[model samples]
Target: MSPKPSRGTTRTTQYQGNPRRILVGITGGSGVIYGVRLLEVLQQKEKDGIETHLIISPAAAITIKAETDYSSRYVEKLATKVYRFGNIAAPLASGSFRFDSMIIVPTSMHTLGAIASGVSDNLIVRAAEVALKEKHRLILVPRETPLTLIHLQNMVRAAEAGAIILPAMPAFYEKPKSIDDIVDHLVGKILDLLEIENALFKRWEGLSYS
Candidate 1:
């Protein structure tokens, strides 16, 4: 568990020449690997002075165990800070918390509906609300197949509310060789949206059909 922040106290990231602070949220979605890979890349960025704050839903813990070999404990260790899902008092639950952006990897439909309806029942939802109100970057990576009209409508609503709805759709143009390649492609796109530099996947070049 990460250390708790004092009530109403401002939490600041390491201010060593414009370091990027990111907030990541993981929910009970099928593509838990997406969240795992994202953390791995962010951990590497620590050398560059980037700081990451993570929040994992209880359902996400079960999904992570079922979907991957890694334990939730290991995943938490990858982040610079971890906040309890129900800890609405966490610094990240406020707009005053200095972070560049927030990304919800494997954003479950339930979370999506909640955020779209302006519900802030939990820390993750509260943090996302703070991001939107503060006009900070907010990315949602939903991971569900056969999205229903309700899901699509929620996505549109979130987008209209200034949230980037980036679904976990990997492109085949990159000719991925392994599962990691595909995973990196999605993560790379997420990084791009965050304006973070990464060479995790091959970029598209001009092509000709002759």
Candidate 2:
């Protein structure tokens, strides 16, 4: 059987490279802001020699316009390289192209289902499959609530295939002060999963019952 998800800190281990390569896939989902904020954080990491590769699905482009003020063009500029979702020929589609990790922020149920079923009709799914087959990190942040049995089964299938199924659920214990604070909390967790360091949100120390 595929190994159970590692409860250890293996995900935090940084690979040695001048510029650690990270691939991001954005699908059409309600929380487009999660992907956008993640891009913003990684762009800053660019100054520290981190290379960010991006692929935004066609539906994501529409979601970006519908949900946020920022244009997809602006988001594209945040990445070191941006690939078309339909470009199955992109380097990321090959397992030979090395990247530290791949994350699909605000991943749609459709994309999750596709990945679960080993469907690689698009570059995003192909790259995610590459990550899984190559034994590299693949994180999927699904945003849907009131999940149906089908959705849960798909999630389980993806997890069994060695993908990190991170739902876009925020913790209120951090005492978020604004919308950005909540977004940062989720982005920070994604960074944490990929072993990237960040101070995007307040960490909980402990609770005092006194």
Give the TM-scores of the predictions, in the order they appear.
0.90, 0.93
Tens-digit lDDT string for candidate 2 (1-210): 756753322443246755788899999988989999999999998877788899999999999999999999999998999999999999989988977889999899999999999999999999998988888888999989899999998998888888888899989998889999999999999998877889998888999899
Per-residue accuracy of model 1 over 87-108 as CA lDDT, tens digit each:
9999988878878788999999
RMSD of 1: 7.6
lDDT comparing candidate 1 with the true structure: 0.88
Give the range of the ten consecutive residues with the poorest summed lDDT in model 1: 2-11
Off by over 4 Å in 1: 1-18, 208-210
Task: Name the lDDT value of residue 110 in candidate 1.
Answer: 91
lDDT of 1 at 85: 99
Q: Model 2, which residues run further than 4 Å from truth? A: 1-16
Residue 200 lDDT in model 1?
89
Number of the top-ranking candidate, with lDDT as the measure:
2
Question: Largest TM-score belongs to which candidate?
Answer: 2
Shift of residue 117 alpha carbon in model 2, Å: 0.3
